[model samples]
Target: MPTCPSPRAPNGSSSAQLPVREKELTRQYDLLASARRGLPMVRVDRDYIFEGPSGKYRLVDLFEDRLQLIVYHFMFDPAWEKGCPACTRYVDALRDLSMLTRRNTAFALISRAPFPKLETYQKERRWDRLWGSSFGSDFNYDFRAALDEKIPTVH
Candidate 1:
């Protein structure tokens, strides 16, 4: 009997695919799709204030009326001593994410950094992706990314 070559994972390792039950698969998919429904339809179309190199822009308008929003909430708050390297990696990879808007999906990065601060960081890191600083906004609070004083730091 001949053996077949296993599929290679992105990490250059061979891993066997896991088996799945058809019924359970269907249930998982349905639950995920339902998350987008049963909401008061928070108008994700409204343009919010955002500044770029050229000038200011309404954030939602940049997507050109796409499938709502795909905001990448980041940890660029002043509370942190420095920008997160993990977050930096994500932002660096995100420069090529224009496809999201091309696929009719609005894409943006939300950070607590002031626009000027973010601009400085971007220049230092050589980041060229479209990003926005949500200064003076409750975006972090609304999205539950805000730091909780009650929660103790494990590290």
Candidate 2:
């Protein structure tokens, strides 16, 4: 009977040779990270308003006194009754983000749908994450999240 070959590394070589390749990959990743950090930054000059569960809030308020803020552009057109299925799936896959708080970072989800609709959906999904509505505001368009001109205007 013929014996199967030993398990190989991702490059099809023997696993014993992975140490050198792993070090090279680690260096490449470190360099890529440094390049990303050196990229130019754009300053947000406009004071956009968003409606949340409590009330209207300014863009700066979303930071929650954190040093950094990460916004997830959720796709939920004003005319649609429900949010985009792909965006919903992405939200569903997210695990606990408490680590971001400990790191002095804040996260929020922004969508073009009305605040009422967002509130209903949030309740249905049982998501307690910070969510805000950019409805009737230019925040979505300015951020390039709502680029489609065919979307119906919210009245």
**TM-score of each model, paired residue for residue:** 0.60, 0.72
Clashing pairs in 1: none
TM-score of model 1 (CA atoms): 0.60
lDDT of 2 by residue, 1-155 (tens): 89675645356566767677899999999998898689799999999999999999999999999999999999899999899898899899998999999999999999999999999999998888899999999998776678477654321
Clashes per model (N, Cα, C within 3 A): 0, 0
Highest lDDT against the true fold, candidate = 2
Model 1 lDDT, full chain set: 0.67
User: Which whole-number lDDT from 0 to 100 does residue 41 have in model 2?
Assistant: 90
Q: Report, for every candidate in turn, its global Cα lDDT versus the true structure.
A: 0.67, 0.89
Give per-residue CA lDDT, model 1, range 1-155, as digits (tens). 99766554444343433223566788887887786465565554434576666567776555657766777776788555457788888777765666775787877666777788778887898977667777776656655676657543221
Q: Report per-prediction Cα RMSD to one decimal.
A: 8.0, 7.2
* Model 1, C-alpha of 49: deviation from truth (Å): 2.9
Candidate 1: worst-modelled 10 consecutive residues by lDDT: 11-20
After superposition, the stretches of candidate 2 with alpha carbons farther than 4 Å from their true spots are 1-38, 149-155
